[model samples]
Target: MGVIIVLIGMLLSVNLSIALDELPCHFLDSINITDGNRLANDDSIEFNGLVYSRKQYAEINYVLLRDGTDQITVDPYIRGCICNIKPCVRLCCPLGTLNTDDTDITVCQDHDKGNKFEAEVIHKNNETKVIPLERFFAYIEGIPCNFVYFDDDYQITHKGEISRGNLSTKLTHQNSCLHAGLNAETNEVDLRLLTCIELEGDDYDLNQYHVIRHQIINFCMLISVVFIVATLLAYIFIPKLRNLQTNCLICYLICLAISYSLVIFVTSFGYPSFACIPFGYFLAFSFFSAFFWLNVFNFDFWVDFQSKHRFKQMSERKKFYLYLVYGFGGPCLLILFIYILDNTVQLPPNMRPGIRDGACFISNILWYFYTPIGITLTINYVFFLLITLKIRKIQQDIAAERSQEDGSLMQKALNEKKETCILYLRLILVMGLIWIMEIVSYLMDNFSPLFLITDILNSLSGLFIFILFIVNRRVLRLIKERWQNLRGKATTNDNDTSNLISRSAAFMQMNPILTIK
Candidate 1:
């Protein structure tokens, strides 16, 4: 039931997005539309008044102009009206009141070829709208205007004159004819039909960013895959070469190697282009990492175990068993437990590969929530405690044996003890450090806000393995030794002539008169 609900929700959301995207480019039939038939501009239309003997009239037209181009012909569908409000008052002709309306009528009037006239919205539907004209103009400047107007004057001689100027200044300024009557009892002006003219600017398309981001994400996935494969092969094919194969360190490499490969494969190659990387890899590798460390932990156990000490150096089977129990067992349990939780409860967003972009690592759930952490800590603590007791007993036994040994043997035993303890401590420290990183990684994956920082730090897990295994002191020493050996061989070859000369001289001395064939 729950699965069905989730599926339904996902389908609905995706479908809605697709549906909205599929709509025609010209969605709104505004008075004025921009290029691509998108936004409405205010300058697309102009309304002008028709004058007569003491009376005037109005009409309007819709004009289709290419975005950013010159004005075109007027449309006949839209209409405008012009009327005189109060009787002709003061000779100064303070302001002309044109009817402000809901219908498409944009009025622009210059009372004098000299008197600067302005239009302002006063009484709309016979009620006072508190917003002032200047305030409204400032507010509307940001928003796309659907209507535009020009001053069209019809002469008494049946001739019309078109004065070209910004309709906004006429409508917004105080003294313009488009302004309402300030006198409250007089002043009337002529209003023409509102015009619709198409205008144009920026907001044309918005899909470019989405496309670029998608491609970038896919590119990252591809690169990550390549690196994963290369690093994994490097480990698998390259022999220990030195201290590279020493402890649970290989586990770290294996975890990262496998994790990234899975991430790339899941993200780059699947149905719908990507699939949620199955948590199985995380479960497997994380556990493997833990298990490997556990093996490092168990080395002390195997070395101190009665009769097992001799087998440790020679028996591969015993080593394998120790590794399996310590490194593999705990992580297996932990991963399975996490898997169970994932199945039973909704995992955190990070844990679940975005149904959109398929990849997953230690998500916020494991990092922030202490459930998995507390469990891991408890297990490690118990193992440490057990190992500590074992180590103490081993020390005690060595001490007892030391007292009975002769002076020379005692010294040898003491030296070996010191070396073992040093190696043991080093192993413990390295392993502990790796574990600490694991915990830190989990915490960071959960709580860290900076994505780039988290990503860089996440690489630390893999990087530590690469450096430790690929460039350990033991490995470097082996390389150096091999280089020196090769150099020595080359030197001997270079001395071949000297050896031959000595041999020839010796032969001549022995045979008094030596003749060459």
Candidate 2:
């Protein structure tokens, strides 16, 4: 009976020891610093990091440990020890206080001396060795962490992540026009010997001088929204404006409006994961739709100039249907293809979406967004150039015909042709300029004055469209006529009301018994 009881006691002791040993250590990489900053005083956690710095003072000892994600200062105290001893003995430390530190370290904590903690240190062969407290925490080998790179302007340009043994990753700084080859190992990055390559063009500081630029862009977008709304209303209410050409313009305006609205929303509230999908989708779709409509416009303009008689013969409904397919349908297909690629393919760390410079934007701009836009813009620009040359030739022919003709009516017709040609030329020039600036800005990674110009022009695209198509002399005349008709109806109704009152008074006067009141 005694032997059985002793065996049972031994098994229970072994089980309890296993349970204590199995307790999980809290990893620094897993804990978000933003949330960890809010931890309660009584809560205990373990984290592992590389000891990057150490300071010894009469009062206390300070050690800075860097986990790939962040850094924290730890105060290692040896209880009941005086500074008189040349060799320090090891002791266990507890209840150390951590505060915030700001330096090259992404995030760091400063340890206060007021917190009482014990640490163990040993002296051997005239050298002092201390057991690493980090060993108590789990050691992370390779994991991704966000890195922010600031340019000369102090403006954030590149944001990405680096993991252990990632030596070939390239980081760019637009202001200096240089690229940094990262060497990462064992939860630390050494930027001491960076390789740089110079690029063309003088760089300017957007961070220092962006206030005025932002003001200009904001004003342009505000006016653009107003004009876009007005133009949309006119297209809906006016029957004469609902032709094939105007239909394409309406689609373009709708896409621009959606894009601009989303930009405002993201800049104001931010792009959290909860809102990222829908916001990213609509933003991309609108950009695609805008370019696709521009392509449709280029094609239509070419057809109109090349074969005016054939264009006139073609049914408006058929043209509208064709434009819809190319403008809306093409973008839809492209977006879907991108969506599939994003889901199936494994993306690099820098290409994945998350917080960048404290702002959330669609990641992988080169592959997912800019490539399609560049292709579309190239095709449209080619078409537009060809159309411009053709129209100029037509205008010259009309002028020559007018020179030979004797009638004033013929001269008037030639003048009208000249005006139409000039208008088309101006339209193409403005659109081309905006897109060219956009491409350049992206290529240069939005360096300086070029980026400023691109932002302003892009924001005011709606305003340009409204002025070119909606606020014309003919549209103004139509609006005036409509207003006059509405006023006439209103006045007529008021006069009819007065007459009915007069007739009622006459009837009451005629019938005295009926006028009892």
Output the worst ten-in-a-row residue range by lDDT, candidate 1.
154-163
lDDT of each: 0.39, 0.50
TM-score of each: 0.37, 0.54
lDDT, residue 285, model 1: 51
RMSD, every candidate, angstroms: 25.4, 20.0
Candidate 1 structure, TM-score to reference: 0.37
Clashes of each: 23, 7
Q: List candidate 2 stretches off by more than 4 Å.
A: 1-135, 138-216, 308-313, 347-361, 395-421, 445-447, 489-517
Q: Name the weakest run of 10 consecutive residues (lDDT summed) in model 2.
A: 50-59
Reference-based lDDT, residue 182, model 1:
25
Q: Clashing residue pairs, candidate 2?
A: 90-120, 90-121, 91-119, 91-120, 92-118, 93-118, 99-110
Over the stretch 333-378, how does candidate 2's per-residue lDDT look in tens digits?
9767766655455565466432221233446777667678778878
